[model samples]
Target chain A: MPENTQEGFIDQQKVLDNEEYSIKNTQSIIQKAVDWFRARSMFVLAYGTGCGAIEMPPIFTSRYDIERLGVVGVATPRQADILIVSGYCSYKTLKRVIRSYEQMNEPKYVIGLGSCTINGGMYWDSYNTIKKLDEYLPVDMYINGCMPRPEALIEGFVKLQDNIRNAKSEAGYIQYRENNAFYRANQEKIFGKNTTPTFEENFAGMNQ
Target chain B: MFNFAMTPLGNLFFGLTLIVFASLLLIKNERRDLPLHILLFASLGVIFYASDLITLFVGWEIMSWSSYFIIAKSARIETLQKYIIFNLAAGFALLGAIVLIVAFAGTTLYGEIDFGKVPEALRVPITLLLFVTIAIKSGIMPFHYWVVDTYEESDHIFSAILSAIISKAGIFLFIVIFSQIIGYRYLHGSLFDILAWLGVITSIVATFKAISQEELKRLLAYSSIAQIGYIVTVLALLEGSGIEAGLYHTIIHTLVKLLLFVNIASIIYITGKTKFSQLGNLLYDYPALFILLLIGIIALAGMPPLGGFNSKFLIYTTLLEKKKALLLVAVMFSSASAFLYCYKLIYGIYLGQASGDKEGYRELPMSFYIPQFIAAIILVLLGILPSLGIALFNPILGSLGFEVSSYSSLFELHTAFASFNGGVLMGLFGLVFALILLLVTSMRSKAVKVRDRYDISYCGETPDPQNNLHYGYGMGQELRRISFIRVILENSTATYWEHISKLSGDSSVMVKKLYSLGTQYIGLFILLFFTILLFLGVR
Candidate 1:
């Protein structure tokens, strides 16, 4: 009790215990209801960074008809719930991805599409392309394939939806918020100090 | 002798002038035009208070000439030519009408002269001349050729005066000469019908023209023409209720224009950019100005819970009471189409993304806000107490010998066809707005401010600073795709005027050729003219 009351002192054991307890018991009935609704209606802002963009059209259109599951495509990042980073993210592409990811409202998710986004695929040897997308952005799920098929992308979305509905894993946006420094350090390594949208400026008044 | 008396009508107009001129005084400018502005203000007073035709004409001339000089300070040679020509024509028409009135009534004084004594045949010409003068001054279409260019070219601060006060002077003249003095009973019904249609058409065309404009002032210039068009239409109805509605709209429009113009003037003062394409994403930087402009546009659009809606409600109800279905439809159509330009005005300047470097922009002077705040407050007050304007109009209507509209309270605008409670409407809107605001702000999801203006998502590629992202100039370009709009946009009054000028030029050249054919042909022509005159004299 004295340790808990001490200024500038954190009880690691108590904190871990509290974290486990909160994760298991703190989610109220209201939070579960909210998560249920959030999972049902998903607005995806599919940022076409590489070749994986071609698979999205068939799925969104009459062929695959992804809207049957309450998923829809929106125009702007502000309206989106999920951001799809499709295929390889080059150094230049990564900057915009980071900017767009930062702009979206919280409770947002990110799906890394294709092996290119995971390990750069064929562009792994290229100095320009980022090999691992998660190093820069908190990717919630990755569909693995050189160029992921439409079915694989659909599977990845289904898995993500299930995780979201059950609160099975922490959201990517929360992780991005908590561990922003590590991501920013990785970004600044390539873009230098002059990188646009520095963390300090973007998240200035935002609550931790 | 120049005679002046302050009647309720005169007081109403004088009150409007004082409000406009007082607000304009707050604006600081480099141009030493205060004396000219004062002269213009004095002339408006003379016109409003004058009880005699000679005094009225003198005031009218002074008003035109003073504004002419003010406009001339910044206008180009062609604009000056157009201004003087249109105004001179308007002046001549007024002079002709005054001469006719004096000759027919045998007295220049308004009270002494009985319009009933005037010959029936002569009344048509007098009214026609008065209509021409009013049309030119008030910018009724075809005669409206001078309005946009003159407004666009004038000093920004003076444009407020031009739209808010000078144009209303024409409305005053109509109410005085046509409604009160000549009396609508003496006029032909066909003339009022034609005038109503003309006003509605002018508003519709002007609204579309406003939308297609890229420049801010030019858009505002067309919008001014459009708003005045509504007042002119309702006044043409000539009923007591119609005139009441017209007066209410006049007051609302004056406040709205003052607020909007001063707001835009501050934007121009700070950024030195007048075109929509050059302005964007200024919402955060100048939040107060944005809110003021938002109020202005909302009022301008005539939505509920604003002074604009009360006037529009009155106008529609009056039209319904008169059973003017087609005319009301046209008016409503024009009013509906005005939303596009209203949205463009706010969105172009305040919303979207910043068009240029944020470092270059500076804060507007505190003095610039005085007029806007005054106008905005009055607009809100008028919205809360919609019939407050009607209460003010009662004495003026009584003085004009029209039955004054009755109201139970300041909040209730009672009409023959319909009535509404302003307080209830405003309260509901405020409550809903507050609830929605609370709901949005208190949401669990956090709203992240974008890192920068260029932080918008553009697929995967970063937007270059050089790339233009603002939809200000391009917002209305798509309207041209619609067939009816295309028809209206493609046809211009300028072309019609150009054709007339060309026709006159060709006819003059033919006369010049005939004169150059020889002195013999000139002598023969003069002989023929004199012979016709001598024959008429002999008869």
Candidate 2:
């Protein structure tokens, strides 16, 4: 039941309800615009970790033309919105890849781009390679193949774009922010004390 | 005869004055060298004001030696030797040109130079001599070997002046000698065409060289070379607007270098480090300096809403007006590539994760901020009021005998071919910046500040603070992998200079052997001297 309480003969409940509704509407509209732009323009910093990088050129160049979908390759993480981990990450490459990912600005996404990244593929028995890309970086989607074809890569991008627009799932960045300790602990198991700088978040609860 | 004149004082002087004042205020530690800096300033004044080549040369020598002594105060023996050798060579070149002028024209007065009287055979050599002098002093391309070491090894404040003011002496000489004394008619020949090409190649190569440097100040040194290269290319245009455009850029470069070098100096002073790898995440410690550097680089990159863009705009227009399409393309390419070094500079110093020990780091002295703030305000003002720079240069341009550039209005800076309203541009930029900033902030419920400097996103792996994550040293290292850039990096003037040095050393050793007083050697010398004399007599 809705409370029909009045304060000093004024309809305070009605006023509060109206204000909340307006604020919510404004926030939602702004959010929608942000999400639309984020989906429309994606600057990917493609970290070629393994053989999967072989497939990237065909998709980005004249043949597949990723730019047609507003996805462009950038030189640095600072200007990029997407970090495409395009194969198996050795412990060494993982450090640099993570550094690159962290350097990118906010509203960023990660796409695990090959079977090696998904489950180590042929490198499953290897001493150097890591399995399960999401255990390290927050991966929004994974494209499975020994090396994904250009068509498969394009399809993955389209799906990622749709997911971004509809907000179908929790964004990887938010997930990482919420559970960074879990990621940090797993990363520490391999890298030990030599890991990249800690991603610090000052929690209000901690302050109290 | 020495003649001194200082009118049409120009944008260059205006900028020089600002930097001098800023440096004076900024210098707190080096009280003794204040006099030397002042003397350099006075000599530069003489060079700028001189009405004759003799007076200009005198000022140039004084400026060079005073700066040499200041550099020697802190520089290594090798660096000092390189500094003196290159500068002395430049000095002799200027002297040679002046002698040629006096012999040909029979006058030392700048305005009295009758280039028409100079024989066509001699004109090119004289101009070439003067161009060499300018190139060596300004550290243009192949002659730029001395600049990096001297800049890297010098006292930081002096480095600021060396780059900001001393380098401009070359541009001053070029303007006074080539554009005014030699006249455009003689310069329109193949000589000027070669100069234009040299400037283009120098800028392109230096841009890559700057990108490859690991040391912070060395990067700035190479950047200085590249910027001066553009000025050289424009000055080679020998057109009305080209000279004006050069002066405008000269002023902007002066301010930008002063701001950037001082910002680095402050960082160096605090940390006692000059390499990029040694410094990182300073933004948290010195946000103000970071902001100043950002402003400096924004202008240096020639982006709009800053004074740099106005000059760059004028330069492009001047090149376009002359229909130097390919030259324009090359210049544009060089300018476009400059963005990498500029990014590397700011990033190396301030951004990314903290890589160094933060303990014992003190705030930069109040004196350091003085220059940076002044430059920042001026850059912003010039961005909004670009015509102020043009208006400042108008009298100088008028005095130089070029037609004064006309603007559509006080707010719109106009060349013969193009025009832009700086005021409108600034207003639009401000409005858009505000809108975007507001939009970004309102979208967020609250900010998630990083918990620690080390807390960066690593692949599920924790980053050990011990591991170096700052990409400062390696930022542009990949550029060398490009085939064209690879060739450039592989072929350097080091080998050429090394060969010359070796040849000189070997000849000196042989001469020393001849001088050694063995009885047999003395008798042989006497015989050889008599033989040479007998041969001359017989002839």
Candidate 3:
């Protein structure tokens, strides 16, 4: 890769390193205990924006029984802790996906599912689909495949749980909150100024 | 001759009327019928204070006619017709009973007239007549045909009056006539039992009907019927405690209905919408009204830590003391199912997604909040001091010749079976609620208010303004899936009344045939009628 393209990759590594350092330095016994509890319970709101939704039933049901790993599905974004943005994100679908992601309570995480969500997979060159999901929404983990199996999905969940428990990676929610302008700018490039409601002050006339 | 006295029972009802009327007047907007409102108030005073049947009948007639005119201002022609017919029938029944009393006992005075002086043959007819009058007024089953329409069609403020004050007149009549004048000895135990069953059945059926209502006022109208049914059941026991229970329920229901109706009236005033489907997501827009409504419904549902629970507690204890197990069970069933409608009421107007545009809604005037605030404060106070109402009722009970219930303190609501501490219950609940609120607010994870109302998770599909997101109309629709509820919802008293009307129409048509006959036939029929009358008179 040329030096210019590698600069973006290098910057991401630096952000991850800073996150790890901060986690090690600030985590007290109570903080670690809190993180452990948070990791033990996860309420997932599976968006299933595209083809990847078919794999979720087996993981939730008796076949995979993902509940054994302390992961469960919730009905609304308000109660959810993790939002799985599964498969391709068309311009229209991305608007709702952004909306659902914003609705989740804080300390939230987003998991990008399938190669479609990673880089649009087979639809990478399509005008309607976005190539990179992370530019619009901060993706904590990306399970890249045309269609990830139930086993791969569960493995992704376990790894995400480990990352949460150990504070091994930068949380997408925190990055989204801190660098909201960057994400908002990218989203606005496609949806214009009215892109999935602004995070800035006085938005919707809400004081807080 | 007319006689009027402020007896304790009368005083209690008069006080309730004053409170309800005062609150209603505060929020009333239509100023055109002020005189008529005064007439209605004055009539209630007459009915309550009258010591003689003649005076009471005059007051009752004035009340009926004045209310009829008031209803006529806003109601449809059919509604007006139904109102007049029902009130006329009620008036005739009262008149019939009074005429019998005056003829047989030679006096209509409450203290002077003796039921024993009346012939045994006439006593049953008098009791039945009085019962018909009371049953129709109180919206008891079968005779309750006219209530729902009248309540729904009346002016909103007048509807509050109808539910809160006017309906209680029947209850007052019951206490005065059956318990005091005729005396319980003249009434059969089986008759009271039947009455109690009728009350419970009315409550159960009306509750199911309330759940299926689409309009806000219609639901409330049904709810008023159901709540009154409870009072009727408890009062039918004819015990001192039962009367006490009924009175307590009466007071709580008055306050709750006033609060709810006023809150809803304000919403209607601001939004110009009456159907639940048209109103939603108003909690943020009108927090005060929402909280008042919450208090109202919480009490209306007979939940703990509210005035409604205190009354329900007293009623249940009274039933348990009487060992009316089946009636108690039925009452409990109705009370439990009430939670569903209560939830629906709240969810429909406040908690769900907004169903319509919000740009047009304006803030209600300060006058609208006055009644709601007063009612809410009183409800909370009653929850803290359960025996406050009992203490008030004690004098009335004694005056009515029933033994007064004893209570050690205002906070403690004592009964034969059990007693609960209202202060402690309220304090405990307040503490828990406060703690939970504090914890949620101070939590590390903050609530992110969505920027737009349409920003809800819809399986990755954006909800459009045209989409019906509110659960208001659909909340209780699924209750029909249950076989028993299906049966209840499917059958309506309106259908039965319609059938009766059709039957009466057929009978009238057959009678009309006689008028169509030739002059010679008419003359022969008149002669036959005179001959039959002479034969009966001679016998």
Candidate 4:
């Protein structure tokens, strides 16, 4: 989807302008490689709604230490790797929740928490509750509880760690390249065909 | 400690920049429709909490103007003008109050403010000015005209932030002013009494209009107003334990309202359906969202064991313990009246037979559902565990010079007697029964029917399902019949200021006309004006 930046546009322009693209080319390639490597530090956008969000502070703080785990909380989905749907979702919250999830990067993981994540838990029937968290998204891990304490939440962190390691080891970069159809289908089901495209950034003029 | 002096709202400001970046890239595409307003909201939480009043002021103005821009995006120019006018009025009031406080106490620092140290004469005016600013921001009664107009006009995502955080920040500021800074104990109870009455009036009136409205978003707007009234009334009460209960209501209300508003947006997004009259058979098309919205509506309506009931119950018990009998009646009336609006919201959108082919609408993506899913899960979990709401309120209450009550998160709310066990027990039992049914249905029914047609058999009369099952059909009509109470409350709360604005406008015009009576008398009028001005100035 990205426009051919290096060889096609830059090289062609150099030939037309009779300027050398070779002088700074190697330095640029090294910098690009460095950026790609550093950007690999995955940030998770923890959209913690309920009691499970209570567990996040401990996980991120000095206790369990999510930062040591190389997982820090980011503000928006675009900057995140994991989307933690901590607990209970109402129809009211679900709308924004869906928007946040869609906002995340291509390689994303969704973790459903508390008993509400698996089923409605105690509020299975008083209405205004979702029965299963997976029904809405392709959840990687689902933690069970009426309210999961901090200890169990750390356990979820460990499990997610293991899953990431395993997927990376077996699949290589190929799995990363694999189109996320499950995530795609979830998006299609929720947003429908008339997706308001994200073309707001009008970077109309750029020499590069 | 995060250095308040250095990075006051540092986390929030960076977040705001990201959203602005996203909005700038706000190509008219629907896929990336998050406006800059959404990002700016993250800024508000940090700004209001800063220890320095100067830092607080910056965040305050940014929040005001950013929100103003959002309103301007959707509302007519005139409405946007009114919105900004009201906000500017509050801003000027805030500036005047701060200047007076600085003059009297010789400090603009938040930590240095000591109400006891301030001279008595300056105290009342300062307190009055601060309270007016708080009232305007929180949309309490007469100063609240901006909220309804803004909510009705805003994009749903922006409205959700406005309802959840904007007013909350105002109430938060008021708590900071009254409890920590001003400490006006003698006047506290009477002030709350008036606010509680205003909340009752708004709830009774808004709930009535909420019931009658055919447009779904307007009903949600009314619901936001009524919910905020309860929040403001609780803030006015300012009790130690009630702070937790009040904030618990805020937490649950935010989660619950976000759930409802998002679901409302989903309906709008899916079918482009705005009114209840234009919508039907959604369950047949978008089943997942249908079921999700159904649960959200129920919990919001205060069904037991869901998140809404926990806080609503706590609010009731708090009133009862205070043994404010009249307050209890008002609480019950507002709580009960909510059902009318909530019922109409859900049934109007999702219930009844399908309008046509079941395949017309597709389910929304995980991106959108994630937001609702997170909020919904929290609502019910907290509802069953009302004590969780209190525990969360502990740190917030402690900052305001209050001790955190040891309320039970499970069945006991801090104090044993003050807690609620009824909703918890009932909710647990319901979950068990539903699971039992799910197992049985799966056991007996291996192969389920996959028929897609939602239409009825041709054995019948004119079979327009949507026409027959339109919103405003049964319950909506019945609610209208009992709507006289709403009509009364709408006319009931006309304040003294409404008449004042009218009176001043007319008086000023007459004075202007009298001064311009005739060109011939202009010289004499000028001479007389100078003579009178000199006499008054000399005295």
Candidate 3 C-alpha lDDT tens digits along B1-539: 78999898998899889998887787648533989999999999999999999999999999999999999998899888877888899999999999998888888899988888888778778877887898889999878888998998888888889999899999999899988778887776677788889899999999999999999999999999999999999999989899999999999998899888888888888998999999899999889889999999999999989999999999999999999999999999999999999998998999888887887777788988887788899999999999999999999889888898899999999988999999999999999999999999999765656566666657646677788899999989999999999999998788888898899999999899977989999899999999999999999
Docking class of 4: incorrect
- In terms of TM-score, the best-performing candidate is 3
- Model 1 misses residue B327 by how many Å? 1.1
* Candidate with the larger TM-score of 3 and 4: 3
Q: For candidate 3, what is the DockQ-based docking class?
A: acceptable
Q: List, residue by residue over B1-539, the lDDT tens digit for candidate 4.
A: 22143232232233333332332232232533355455465457546556656656667778888888766667777668657877787787787777776676676666687656667677667766776677678776667667676776777666666666676666667666677656646244565677667766666666766776778878887787777777666656667756656666766666666667667777776676677776766766667777677667767677876777766776776777676678779767877888877877777777755444334445554555655676777766765666666666666666666776765335555453355564556667788899998888877323323132222222212234445545443555565344566454345333554576569779999899978789768878899999999999999
State which candidate, 1 or 3, has the greater DockQ: 1
Candidate 3 Cα misplacement greater than 4 A, ranges: A1-30, A46-69, A83-96, A112-133, A142-162, A178-195, A198-208, B359-363, B506-513, B526-539
Per-model TM-score, in order, reads 0.88, 0.75, 0.89, 0.62
Residues B1-539 of candidate 2 have per-residue lDDT tens digits of: 67886567534573576565555455687534778877877787788788887888898899899988889888899989888999999999889988988898999898888988888788878888888899998988789889989999888877788888888888888887877887887764577878888988998998899899989899999899999999999998888788888998988998899999899989988998888888888887799999999999999999988999999999999999999999999999999999999999999889987676778776677888888888889899899888888787778788878888766566788877878898999999999999999998997534556667665545334577788999998898898789999888778888998899999999999999878769987998899999999999999
Native-referenced Cα lDDT, model 3: 0.88
- For model 2 chain A, give the 10-residue run with minimal summed lDDT: A198-207
| Residue B507 of model 2, lDDT score | 100
Tell me the lDDT of model 3 at A37.
Answer: 88
Candidate 4 lDDT over residue span A1-208, tens digit each: 2235665554444443342422233335654554344334548777776667877888888977767656788876656667788888775465556556644544567778899878788778847766676655667667788677767766776666654543312211122224445544544555565332321111111101
For model 4 chain A, give the 10-residue run with minimal summed lDDT.
A199-208
Best by DockQ: 1
> How many Å off is the CA of B510 in candidate 1?
6.2
Model 1 TM-score (2 dp): 0.88
What lDDT does candidate 4 reach at residue B351?
75
